[model samples]
Target: FRKVVHIEQGGLVKPERDDTEFQHPCFLRGQEQLLENIKRKVTSVSTLKSEDIKIRQDSVTKLLTDVQLMKGKQECMDSKLLAMKHSFSS
Candidate 1:
């Protein structure tokens, strides 16, 4: 997320806020990490380590869920910022 505050003469004017894109590089990196974790989970299962497989799967699920939530929030914020910009520009 990015925040822009407009100020003049050492006083506050207005604050403009924006959120980064959901599909930005940072979000993609999280996806990549989740994929890597899945791969590890598969390898663990293949090695007959059921407990390790379960743990890895749980971790991967949590991470993916987190990423999804963050992306959703970012998109929402972006939309709100766009609306605010439109309103201010009008």
Candidate 2:
């Protein structure tokens, strides 16, 4: 009689195979290590992407503030030029 293997998934246990060859210790360890490595890589990439987006947002906000400051300076300069012109014309 062959050994039976029951695979549990999603709260359900189902018989998968009748062979014992799939229960190798080295193979299981390698699979576990591969899954862990994949998880780490995914987490690293996700964090990098999130930080990149935040950096871009901060750059955009700084640029907007710089533009507003330039506009204010331009308005002040225009008012000063107009006052000078009026005094010179008089």
Candidate 3:
């Protein structure tokens, strides 16, 4: 915004003398393309982040399930070892 120091001098936002560059069709289309590209890139990045989150959740669930299964097996093995030790002592 241009600061008009003297309001009496009539610098009240006149149109530019040459607007040929702004009026060019290529400039307008290029600006739209730039906006579209930025939106598309943001959407793709967001999608990737969502997919990564899902993958992380799935991996963590699988890991916990695996650990639970191993815990059960270990308990069973410990019981079997105790039984074997008692049999050997008797």
- Model 2 regions more than 4 Å off: 1-48
Candidate 1 pairs with clashing backbones? none
Task: State, as a TM-score between 0 and 1, how close model 3 is to the true structure.
Answer: 0.47
Clashes of 2: 0
Estimate candidate 2's alpha-carbon lDDT, on a 0 to 1 scale.
0.65
TM-score of 2: 0.47
RMSD of 3: 15.4
lDDT of 1 by residue, 1-90 (tens): 223333432235332443322222233554666444332113443676889778989999999999999999999999999999999999
Q: Which pairs clash (backbone N, Cα, C closer than 3 Å) in model 2?
A: none
Q: Which stretches of candidate 3 lie over 4 Å from their true place?
A: 1-48
Question: Lowest-lDDT window of 10 residues in candidate 2?
Answer: 34-43
Off by over 4 Å in 1: 1-48
- Candidate 1, residue 63: CA error in Å? 0.9
Residues 1-90 of candidate 2 have per-residue lDDT tens digits of 223344443224543543343333333454766443332113555567787889999999999999999999999999999999999999
**Cα lDDT tens digits for candidate 3, 1-90:** 123234443456654552322132233443776443332113555567777888999999999999999999999999999999999999
Query: What is the lDDT, from 0 to 100, of the residue 83 in candidate 1?
Result: 100
Predict model 1's lDDT versus the native.
0.63
